[model samples]
Target: MTTISCTYTGDLHCEATHTGSGATLSTDAPLDNEGKGEAFSPTDLLATSLATCMLTIMGITARSRDWSIEGASASVDKLMSSDGPRRIETLRVTLQLPEALDDDQRALLQRVAEQCPVKRSIVPLINAEIHWA
Candidate 1:
């Protein structure tokens, strides 16, 4: 397993370091939560993680099949719950696939995107709506 190290900075901000590559990223609270919102909030990262993971997995699957998945894109919309802990209740993702794919390849890529590791990991907790075109 890979390891990620995080250091909490002040004012709802923090830095995360990827141990393998020594690359780092900064995170801050969202604008609604009172921080500067200059960077990605934790919740925003969570949403982004899902979208990126799906795309990456699909790319790998396409490559393995000798298919080119270039120009494939994904969009994410996160919904926050109101009554409870203000947590993310749903993530709606729309993937615009390259028009060059055949119907079978398109269906295969869609399945791969939805079955990625992060999707499985967050299943039953976050409602994921996946749209492919």
Candidate 2:
């Protein structure tokens, strides 16, 4: 298990440190949620994780097959519910892949991304839309 330490820096900001990696990050309250919108809020990180996880897994798959999927990136758009108990309603992801991917390769990569551990794990919790480009 990993332990994170966070200290409120006042004015709707918090400094978070990752003990394992000696990395530090800052979080700001989302604009819609209140407080001055600045850095990424914690929920933003969650949405980002899902998208990055899919990309990472797909990269690993390509590496294993000796395929170079360079110039590929994933874009994630998160929508939050406006009602009480505010929470993320959907995460729309679009992956831009290199031109090297053919029909079969595209299908395989799509399957891999959708079946990635993080994607499957969050299936019961969030609505994720994955698109290939």
Candidate 3:
């Protein structure tokens, strides 16, 4: 298992350290939530995690198959609920992959991306709309 340690730095801000790699990141509340909005908010990180996880898994699959996805990229837009109970309502993801791939390869990568750990864990809880280009 992996471990991450976090410290609340006051004023709706927090710092997290990845124990494995010593990597660190900071998070702040969004402007709408009474914060400076100078950095990625918690919900933003959630959306980012999904997109990055999908790309990472897809890259792994492509590498295993001797395929190149060197320029593959993904973008995500996070939408929050306006009704009761503040939470994420939707995460719209657009994936752009290299054009050199064939139909079968593209299909395979799409499947791999859909089955990514983050996507499998968060779907239905948060509506995820994925688009490929």
Higher-ranked by TM-score: 1 or 2 = 1
| Winner of 2 and 3 under lDDT | 3
| Reference-based TM-score, model 2 | 0.89
Model 3 regions more than 4 Å off: none
lDDT string for model 1 (98-127, tens) is 988999998888888889888898888999
Model 1 ranges off by over 4 Å: none
Ranking by lDDT: 3, 1, 2
Clashes of each: 0, 0, 0
Top-scoring candidate (TM-score): 3
Which has the better TM-score: candidate 1, or candidate 3? 3
Q: Rate the local accuracy (lDDT) of all candidates.
A: 0.91, 0.87, 0.96
My TM-score estimates for the predictions, one after another, are: 0.95, 0.89, 0.98
For candidate 2, give the lDDT: 0.87
